[model samples]
Target: MTPTFSQLIRSPVLFLAFGFGSGLAKKAPGTFGTLAAVPLWYGLQFLSPLAYMAVIVITFALGCYLCGAASTKLGVHDHGGIVWDEFVGYWITMFMAPAGWLWALYGFVLFRIFDIAKPQPIGWADRKVHGGLGIMLDDILAGIYAALVLQGTAYLISHF
Candidate 1:
Protein backbone atom coordinates (compact mmCIF):
# COMPACT_ATOMS: atom_id res chain seq x y z
CA MET A 1 0.00 0.00 0.00
CA THR A 2 1.11 3.52 -0.65
CA PRO A 3 2.07 5.57 2.38
CA THR A 4 0.33 8.81 3.29
CA PHE A 5 2.14 12.13 3.08
CA SER A 6 2.25 12.44 6.85
CA GLN A 7 3.78 9.02 7.26
CA LEU A 8 6.44 9.92 4.74
CA ILE A 9 7.09 13.32 6.31
CA ARG A 10 7.08 12.19 9.91
CA SER A 11 9.43 9.29 9.39
CA PRO A 12 12.25 9.42 11.93
CA VAL A 13 14.77 8.50 9.33
CA LEU A 14 15.30 11.80 7.56
CA PHE A 15 13.86 15.31 7.41
CA LEU A 16 14.91 15.29 3.78
CA ALA A 17 12.31 12.62 3.07
CA PHE A 18 9.62 15.25 3.30
CA GLY A 19 11.49 17.40 0.83
CA PHE A 20 12.03 14.42 -1.41
CA GLY A 21 8.29 13.92 -1.59
CA SER A 22 8.30 16.75 -4.06
CA GLY A 23 9.93 14.28 -6.40
CA LEU A 24 6.90 12.01 -6.25
CA ALA A 25 5.10 13.96 -8.91
CA LYS A 26 4.02 12.14 -12.07
CA LYS A 27 6.54 13.90 -14.26
CA ALA A 28 10.09 15.14 -13.84
CA PRO A 29 10.03 14.63 -10.12
CA GLY A 30 13.71 15.25 -9.84
CA THR A 31 13.33 18.60 -11.57
CA PHE A 32 10.40 19.42 -9.35
CA GLY A 33 12.38 18.29 -6.37
CA THR A 34 15.23 20.59 -7.34
CA LEU A 35 12.81 23.43 -7.93
CA ALA A 36 11.47 22.92 -4.43
CA ALA A 37 14.82 24.03 -3.15
CA VAL A 38 14.52 27.55 -4.56
CA PRO A 39 12.87 29.12 -1.56
CA LEU A 40 15.44 27.54 0.68
CA TRP A 41 18.23 28.98 -1.44
CA TYR A 42 16.65 32.38 -1.23
CA GLY A 43 16.22 32.13 2.49
CA LEU A 44 19.75 30.95 2.92
CA GLN A 45 21.01 33.91 0.91
CA PHE A 46 20.52 36.04 4.00
CA LEU A 47 23.60 34.48 5.46
CA SER A 48 26.98 35.51 4.13
CA PRO A 49 28.24 33.45 1.18
CA LEU A 50 30.62 31.68 3.50
CA ALA A 51 27.85 30.84 5.91
CA TYR A 52 25.67 29.67 3.08
CA MET A 53 28.41 27.38 1.86
CA ALA A 54 28.83 26.08 5.39
CA VAL A 55 25.14 25.36 5.62
CA ILE A 56 25.35 23.39 2.40
CA VAL A 57 28.25 21.48 3.81
CA ILE A 58 26.31 20.70 6.98
CA THR A 59 23.22 19.79 5.04
CA PHE A 60 25.22 17.36 2.91
CA ALA A 61 26.73 15.77 5.99
CA LEU A 62 23.35 15.46 7.68
CA GLY A 63 21.73 14.34 4.48
CA CYS A 64 24.11 11.40 4.35
CA TYR A 65 22.83 10.15 7.70
CA LEU A 66 19.18 10.97 7.15
CA CYS A 67 18.98 9.64 3.61
CA GLY A 68 20.50 6.34 4.66
CA ALA A 69 17.98 5.83 7.43
CA ALA A 70 15.04 6.90 5.33
CA SER A 71 16.07 4.73 2.38
CA THR A 72 16.29 1.69 4.64
CA LYS A 73 12.96 2.46 6.24
CA LEU A 74 11.31 2.85 2.85
CA GLY A 75 12.99 -0.33 1.58
CA VAL A 76 13.98 1.35 -1.64
CA HIS A 77 17.30 2.25 -3.15
CA ASP A 78 17.53 5.89 -4.01
CA HIS A 79 13.78 6.09 -4.11
CA GLY A 80 12.35 9.05 -5.92
CA GLY A 81 10.92 10.35 -2.68
CA ILE A 82 14.38 10.89 -1.26
CA VAL A 83 15.29 14.03 -3.16
CA TRP A 84 16.84 16.17 -0.46
CA ASP A 85 20.08 15.33 -2.15
CA GLU A 86 18.82 16.85 -5.36
CA PHE A 87 17.78 19.98 -3.53
CA VAL A 88 21.17 20.42 -1.97
CA GLY A 89 23.01 19.45 -5.13
CA TYR A 90 21.16 22.00 -7.19
CA TRP A 91 21.78 24.66 -4.60
CA ILE A 92 25.45 23.88 -4.85
CA THR A 93 25.25 24.05 -8.63
CA MET A 94 24.28 27.70 -8.53
CA PHE A 95 27.08 28.62 -6.15
CA MET A 96 28.26 31.87 -7.76
CA ALA A 97 25.60 32.44 -10.38
CA PRO A 98 23.27 35.44 -10.36
CA ALA A 99 19.90 35.00 -8.67
CA GLY A 100 18.02 35.59 -11.87
CA TRP A 101 15.68 33.27 -13.69
CA LEU A 102 18.14 32.98 -16.55
CA TRP A 103 20.85 31.66 -14.30
CA ALA A 104 18.39 29.46 -12.50
CA LEU A 105 17.32 27.99 -15.82
CA TYR A 106 20.90 27.39 -16.84
CA GLY A 107 21.58 25.67 -13.53
CA PHE A 108 18.48 23.55 -13.89
CA VAL A 109 19.55 22.33 -17.30
CA LEU A 110 23.16 21.71 -16.34
CA PHE A 111 22.23 19.92 -13.12
CA ARG A 112 19.67 17.73 -14.86
CA ILE A 113 22.19 16.67 -17.48
CA PHE A 114 24.83 15.81 -14.91
CA ASP A 115 22.38 14.06 -12.65
CA ILE A 116 20.98 12.03 -15.49
CA ALA A 117 24.26 11.24 -17.22
CA LYS A 118 26.18 10.45 -14.03
CA PRO A 119 29.55 10.64 -15.77
CA GLN A 120 32.69 8.93 -14.44
CA PRO A 121 33.33 9.49 -10.75
CA ILE A 122 29.73 10.37 -10.13
CA GLY A 123 28.70 7.08 -11.66
CA TRP A 124 31.39 5.30 -9.73
CA ALA A 125 30.18 6.72 -6.44
CA ASP A 126 26.57 5.89 -7.24
CA ARG A 127 27.45 2.27 -7.90
CA LYS A 128 30.05 1.61 -5.23
CA VAL A 129 28.41 3.51 -2.39
CA HIS A 130 25.32 2.86 -0.33
CA GLY A 131 23.10 4.80 2.10
CA GLY A 132 22.33 8.52 2.19
CA LEU A 133 25.85 9.77 1.75
CA GLY A 134 26.26 7.49 -1.19
CA ILE A 135 22.99 8.56 -2.66
CA MET A 136 23.69 12.28 -2.24
CA LEU A 137 27.33 12.21 -3.22
CA ASP A 138 26.62 11.37 -6.84
CA ASP A 139 24.29 14.29 -7.20
CA ILE A 140 26.77 16.53 -5.46
CA LEU A 141 29.38 15.51 -7.97
CA ALA A 142 26.95 16.17 -10.75
CA GLY A 143 26.33 19.63 -9.35
CA ILE A 144 30.03 20.26 -9.20
CA TYR A 145 30.40 19.19 -12.81
CA ALA A 146 27.56 21.44 -13.83
CA ALA A 147 29.05 24.30 -11.85
CA LEU A 148 32.41 23.92 -13.51
CA VAL A 149 30.92 23.72 -16.98
CA LEU A 150 28.64 26.65 -16.39
CA GLN A 151 31.39 28.70 -14.86
CA GLY A 152 33.53 28.04 -17.90
CA THR A 153 30.67 28.85 -20.22
CA ALA A 154 30.07 32.12 -18.42
CA TYR A 155 33.74 32.97 -18.62
CA LEU A 156 33.86 32.20 -22.32
CA ILE A 157 30.81 34.32 -22.94
CA SER A 158 32.26 37.23 -21.00
CA HIS A 159 35.43 37.09 -23.07
CA PHE A 160 33.52 37.24 -26.35
Candidate 2:
Protein backbone atom coordinates (compact mmCIF):
# COMPACT_ATOMS: atom_id res chain seq x y z
CA MET A 1 0.00 0.00 0.00
CA THR A 2 1.12 3.53 -0.73
CA PRO A 3 1.82 5.93 2.08
CA THR A 4 -0.19 9.09 2.45
CA PHE A 5 1.34 12.58 2.27
CA SER A 6 1.23 12.78 6.06
CA GLN A 7 3.11 9.53 6.42
CA LEU A 8 5.64 10.54 3.78
CA ILE A 9 6.42 13.75 5.63
CA ARG A 10 7.09 11.85 8.82
CA SER A 11 9.87 9.72 7.36
CA PRO A 12 13.35 11.29 7.11
CA VAL A 13 14.25 9.44 3.94
CA LEU A 14 11.02 10.40 2.24
CA PHE A 15 11.44 14.00 3.31
CA LEU A 16 14.90 14.25 1.74
CA ALA A 17 13.76 12.34 -1.32
CA PHE A 18 11.04 14.94 -1.64
CA GLY A 19 13.71 17.68 -1.75
CA PHE A 20 13.00 19.00 1.69
CA GLY A 21 9.34 19.48 0.72
CA SER A 22 10.19 21.48 -2.39
CA GLY A 23 8.69 18.59 -4.35
CA LEU A 24 5.37 19.37 -2.68
CA ALA A 25 4.97 22.39 -4.92
CA LYS A 26 1.64 22.34 -6.71
CA LYS A 27 3.25 23.37 -9.97
CA ALA A 28 6.55 22.41 -11.49
CA PRO A 29 7.66 20.33 -8.57
CA GLY A 30 10.79 19.33 -10.44
CA THR A 31 11.72 22.95 -10.98
CA PHE A 32 11.23 23.67 -7.33
CA GLY A 33 13.27 20.64 -6.42
CA THR A 34 16.12 21.77 -8.63
CA LEU A 35 15.89 25.25 -7.21
CA ALA A 36 16.19 23.82 -3.72
CA ALA A 37 19.50 22.30 -4.77
CA VAL A 38 21.05 25.65 -5.62
CA PRO A 39 21.80 26.50 -2.01
CA LEU A 40 23.30 23.10 -1.49
CA TRP A 41 25.51 23.57 -4.51
CA TYR A 42 26.62 26.92 -3.21
CA GLY A 43 27.82 25.37 0.02
CA LEU A 44 29.43 22.41 -1.68
CA GLN A 45 31.50 24.79 -3.77
CA PHE A 46 33.66 25.35 -0.72
CA LEU A 47 35.03 21.79 -0.80
CA SER A 48 38.17 20.71 -2.64
CA PRO A 49 37.65 18.77 -5.86
CA LEU A 50 38.46 15.41 -4.27
CA ALA A 51 36.23 16.04 -1.26
CA TYR A 52 33.51 17.28 -3.58
CA MET A 53 33.71 14.09 -5.60
CA ALA A 54 33.54 11.99 -2.47
CA VAL A 55 30.47 13.84 -1.24
CA ILE A 56 28.76 13.36 -4.58
CA VAL A 57 29.55 9.65 -4.55
CA ILE A 58 28.12 9.33 -1.07
CA THR A 59 25.05 11.34 -1.96
CA PHE A 60 24.41 9.30 -5.10
CA ALA A 61 24.62 6.04 -3.17
CA LEU A 62 22.25 7.33 -0.52
CA GLY A 63 19.95 8.70 -3.19
CA CYS A 64 19.70 5.30 -4.81
CA TYR A 65 18.64 3.70 -1.55
CA LEU A 66 16.40 6.54 -0.43
CA CYS A 67 14.70 6.88 -3.77
CA GLY A 68 14.12 3.14 -3.97
CA ALA A 69 12.73 2.94 -0.49
CA ALA A 70 10.48 5.93 -1.04
CA SER A 71 9.24 4.59 -4.35
CA THR A 72 8.50 1.22 -2.76
CA LYS A 73 6.52 2.88 -0.01
CA LEU A 74 4.62 5.03 -2.45
CA GLY A 75 3.97 2.13 -4.81
CA VAL A 76 5.12 4.15 -7.76
CA HIS A 77 8.16 4.32 -9.99
CA ASP A 78 10.02 7.58 -10.59
CA HIS A 79 7.32 9.68 -9.04
CA GLY A 80 7.70 13.38 -9.87
CA GLY A 81 7.75 14.25 -6.20
CA ILE A 82 10.90 12.29 -5.55
CA VAL A 83 13.65 14.75 -6.42
CA TRP A 84 16.70 13.52 -4.56
CA ASP A 85 18.00 12.58 -8.00
CA GLU A 86 17.72 16.21 -9.01
CA PHE A 87 19.88 17.26 -6.10
CA VAL A 88 22.63 14.84 -6.97
CA GLY A 89 22.34 15.55 -10.69
CA TYR A 90 22.72 19.28 -10.21
CA TRP A 91 25.65 18.69 -7.91
CA ILE A 92 27.27 16.58 -10.58
CA THR A 93 26.71 19.21 -13.24
CA MET A 94 28.25 21.91 -11.12
CA PHE A 95 31.35 19.86 -10.29
CA MET A 96 34.58 21.66 -11.23
CA ALA A 97 32.50 24.38 -12.85
CA PRO A 98 33.71 27.96 -12.78
CA ALA A 99 33.36 29.58 -9.38
CA GLY A 100 30.63 32.15 -9.62
CA TRP A 101 26.90 32.68 -9.47
CA LEU A 102 26.79 33.05 -13.25
CA TRP A 103 28.37 29.65 -13.77
CA ALA A 104 25.99 28.14 -11.24
CA LEU A 105 23.05 29.66 -13.11
CA TYR A 106 24.39 28.37 -16.38
CA GLY A 107 24.79 24.89 -14.94
CA PHE A 108 21.23 25.06 -13.64
CA VAL A 109 19.79 25.95 -17.02
CA LEU A 110 21.91 23.38 -18.80
CA PHE A 111 21.10 20.61 -16.34
CA ARG A 112 17.39 21.33 -16.60
CA ILE A 113 17.53 21.29 -20.38
CA PHE A 114 19.38 17.99 -20.57
CA ASP A 115 17.23 16.46 -17.86
CA ILE A 116 13.95 17.50 -19.42
CA ALA A 117 15.07 16.87 -23.00
CA LYS A 118 16.38 13.40 -22.09
CA PRO A 119 18.47 13.32 -25.22
CA GLN A 120 19.68 9.98 -26.65
CA PRO A 121 21.05 7.68 -23.95
CA ILE A 122 19.33 9.63 -21.23
CA GLY A 123 15.97 8.89 -22.82
CA TRP A 124 17.02 5.30 -23.39
CA ALA A 125 17.84 4.77 -19.73
CA ASP A 126 14.66 6.45 -18.56
CA ARG A 127 12.66 4.08 -20.75
CA LYS A 128 14.53 0.85 -20.10
CA VAL A 129 15.52 1.02 -16.43
CA HIS A 130 13.38 0.53 -13.33
CA GLY A 131 13.36 1.25 -9.57
CA GLY A 132 15.94 3.40 -7.77
CA LEU A 133 18.74 2.98 -10.26
CA GLY A 134 16.31 3.87 -13.01
CA ILE A 135 15.24 7.01 -11.24
CA MET A 136 18.84 8.09 -10.74
CA LEU A 137 20.57 7.01 -13.96
CA ASP A 138 18.82 9.31 -16.41
CA ASP A 139 19.47 12.32 -14.24
CA ILE A 140 23.09 11.30 -13.77
CA LEU A 141 23.49 11.07 -17.52
CA ALA A 142 21.80 14.41 -17.99
CA GLY A 143 24.19 15.93 -15.47
CA ILE A 144 27.12 14.51 -17.38
CA TYR A 145 25.83 15.95 -20.62
CA ALA A 146 25.30 19.32 -18.99
CA ALA A 147 28.69 19.22 -17.32
CA LEU A 148 30.37 18.59 -20.64
CA VAL A 149 28.65 21.57 -22.14
CA LEU A 150 29.41 23.77 -19.18
CA GLN A 151 33.03 22.73 -19.12
CA GLY A 152 33.39 23.23 -22.85
CA THR A 153 31.87 26.64 -22.60
CA ALA A 154 34.19 27.54 -19.80
CA TYR A 155 37.17 26.35 -21.82
CA LEU A 156 36.20 28.39 -24.85
CA ILE A 157 35.71 31.49 -22.75
CA SER A 158 39.12 31.05 -21.19
CA HIS A 159 40.92 30.35 -24.48
CA PHE A 160 39.13 32.79 -26.75
TM values, all candidates: 0.89, 0.95
Pairs of colliding residues, candidate 2: none
lDDT of 2 by residue, 3-113 (tens): 456866799988989988887777877778889999999999999999999999999999999999889878889888899999999999999999999999999999999
Alpha carbon lDDT of residue 94, candidate 2? 97
Error of 2 at 38 (Å): 0.6
What's model 2's overall lDDT? 0.91
* CA lDDT scores, all candidates in order: 0.80, 0.91
Question: Which prediction has the highest lDDT against the true structure?
Answer: 2
- Candidate achieving the largest TM-score: 2
For model 1, state the Cα shift of residue 104 in Å: 0.8
Which runs in model 1 stand beyond 4 Å of their true positions?
Answer: 12-15
| Candidate 1 per-residue C-alpha lDDT over 7-101 given as tens digits, one digit per residue, 9 for 90 to 100 | 76676554465474675666776778888987677677567779879988998988887778778877887877677888888888888766677
Off by over 4 Å in 2: 1-6
